[model samples]
Target chain A: MAYSNEVRDSFSKELDGIREAGLFKEERWIKSPQAADIEVEFPAGAEGKKVINFCANNYLGLSNHPDVVEAARIGLGTRGYGLSSVRFICGTQDIHGHLEHRLTEFLGTEDTLLFPSCMDANAGVFEAILGDQDIMIADRLVHASIVDGMRLCKAMRDTYKHSNMEHLEEKLQDHQDKRIRLIITDGVFSMDGDLAKLDEIVALAEKYDAMVFVDDSHASGFIGKTGRGTHEHCGVLSQIDIITTTLGKALGGASGGCVSGRKELVELCRQRARPYLFSNTVAPVIVSGAIKVLDLVSATTERRDKLEWNTKFWRDGLVKMGLDIKAGDSPIVPVMLYNAKLAQDMARDLYEEGIYVVGFFFPVVAKGQARIRTQLSAAHDQHHLEKGLEAFAKVADKYGILGKSKKEIKEMYGL
Target chain B: MEEYKKAILEYVIKEYLEDDEDEEITYDTELISGGIVDSFSMVSLKRFLENKYDIQIPDADASPEAFDSVDKIAALVVRFKQA
Candidate 1:
């Protein structure tokens, strides 16, 4: 056989080692649509259990919105399902241009270019814009996709302390001899739910002649007062040089992303970005739904307001219960458990209580920072949240982790 | 300064390599390239040194090369302390 027994045994042993290390991830089957309440089946062949989902990135709860679904259906009928060619070829449709225009206006950017996903956008953007002479100084806690993108480019990669403007300034000063300096960060950190200090970053960037790049995947649909993005939230909407975001989360929960920023930069990506140049164009259904998503979010702030209220309510509840949670304003609340096994056990118990959550441990986060990352959504009503809080309280009580701080938990669990 | 090295080594072992009880870490042990300390841990380690020494180490001097070992980290802290 082409695949030898030795190689197969080695792979099996590796899998066994991962399981032994309590790091093997098993996927739960979701029979229902992505929403607040989902029917999940664990252990492969078991019966599905209905649970309230608290682990999805569905911030605005537009994933199964009826209107957006109808818009996608209309698009399917009018434009068909897939585009077999790349954008430069025959895949460029009128709807694609229309969606890009709408996104540009919605994000308050000069121009926009669509990509297959935000991962692809990050992967292709750096190599297209920067060369060996340039330097990319990123926040240490930037998303993994940005790291991959930085690796693909020839620019020298450096990092500053997370959200430390002084560190960022020092790095910028050190890189002044380079041709260009780009400061990259996430608008809202996904794990900690903390908002980036864009105002401070922009000030330092201006002082040092460095450009700013923000990946607003977690903050795009419902962050600012008017729900534009973190740039608008930080009062620097037009000042950002590059902003990349996804349509897969709060914006219709479909698969598409874009790089929006200065016209010249976007034009460069359109011409030279490998993902956009070589990969197939985004499907018409996703584009049509994303257009409707922009329309919905732009027309009113009802869903965004609901999401903000939900986040506040959930956070306040968790705090009142004395659970050790990350302090932040975004909806991604991480309840610290410190020990990886304890986090996993607590998540399993929470699942048993009909509240769906996942344990995040080392590799996903830092060592000794294991947590249950609960994401609130606009779809969750007061009743759902109350029940979810009750489930959490019960599970925390069972784990004897209520009111325990991080240090205390570590001392207790031996992290 | 020797105390600083000992404290740094203790913190690294307690925080980053706690699960590996058998792993031996000295002042000259590789922390970054050996994968014992990742970027995230390095941030916290920097913060720990800053808080412990009450000194500001500029990001230019906080590179992984400067933090690859307990001795290097102690030297960086002492430099900031005397500055």
Candidate 2:
């Protein structure tokens, strides 16, 4: 047992290969709380206190919000820490009920059911609702969870071209006579930051007697008046049948998900969903914190507005830098670098300069579509945004990505 | 009938696998843990088995002991035919 041979040696060998290729994920231990500015403890700071953290999913500047933290603590005191049972089996708390009901009202749905995560919320939905006789049509670039869900279901599945309504209509027409047809898509595409054309999807649903489902993981808690989701963004909130979202992304970055939809569908999912019936319920503190988040979203318009302003400002700045930032209003801005090595190298250079961002290429996106996915946060002030952009420009110029000098760049654009 | 079973096994191999060289499977060979058909793909292949043989692979008939390998799958089919 002491002699390393098969499994352990194989693991080390594989990891060494990854290390050689510069692909090993070196997870930094974050020391400080998730705040506007963060601190990470690394081995390099042996003699001195050195810290850095620029990559985080806490977009709305609320990870360290006093009120949200207090709400979580209060709920922990009032209702224990975790239930440790499924929602249907002695795990349903009053706060969970209140959150579900409030979310239903907030999203203009008749009912809602919480899940372990938004991934599960999307994953468990298909097999619960659709069966052998049903058909599921989805956008080509919908999230992985939706694709996995369809795989579990015995539905006739077809993927339309990404955000291409014409191709979606073609698939819908082909499946017009199916017993049930469900059209699914992501509201704000996570990779390119482009939005789904929900208005056309809604019209197609109506024309073909099909229902619509949207995994609004990226769109919820922002992107519209009152921050409903893609449906709200497209002014087709009433047409979408099933609207599922996560608490982890925008709703205070907690650990849960919920599906807001018609009363029958929501109740049916509660009864039949695998995770809801088998897995443990979310902790009471997380739910209570999520409730506070919903309240914050409803009461003040500050968070989402700030996020919108940041997105536009950053997108415009990156485009001006001549790095070919994908055109979109969503906060998931992909600054295109085209080659995998170039994208990864750029990410490394940016990290060294104290700006944390991640490079995504194949198989996350298509080959030759490599990009540095710079996620914007409401926590980032104008100064931080400007400094980050300037750092990006300086590094990008240093890497010779801008093709010529900044004077030539400005002159070419006539700025 | 045995020939039909062989053909069905070969067909399952051809359909599930990516390469024809990978399709050199005996009727008695194991396919599940051999990593040919996954759980989700098993559902579709089960549909094909039922349709091709005109036999419903019942829930009780779909246990690991009977459907775990292609040999076991064939044995289960023969047992069903006798019943």
Those runs of model 1 whose alpha carbons end farther than 4 Å from true positions after fitting are B1-30, B33-83
Q: Which lDDT value does model 1 have at A33? A: 92
TM-score of 2: 0.79
Q: Model 1 over residues A185-205: C-alpha lDDT tens digits?
A: 999999889999999999999
Predicted candidate 1, C-alpha RMSD? 6.0
Task: Give the range where candidate 1 chain B is weakest over 10 consecutive residues by summed lDDT.
Answer: B14-23
Model 1: per-residue Cα lDDT over B13-49, one tens digit each: 7656544235678999988976677654475678679
Show pairs that collide, candidate 2.
none
lDDT of each: 0.90, 0.77
For candidate 2, give the lDDT of residue A174: 70
Q: Against the hidden reference, what TM-scores do the models get? A: 0.88, 0.79
Kindly report which residue pairs in candidate 1 clash with one another: none
Docking class of 2: incorrect
Model 2 ranges with Cα > 4 A deviation: A1-4, A7-23, A42-54, A403-415, B1-83
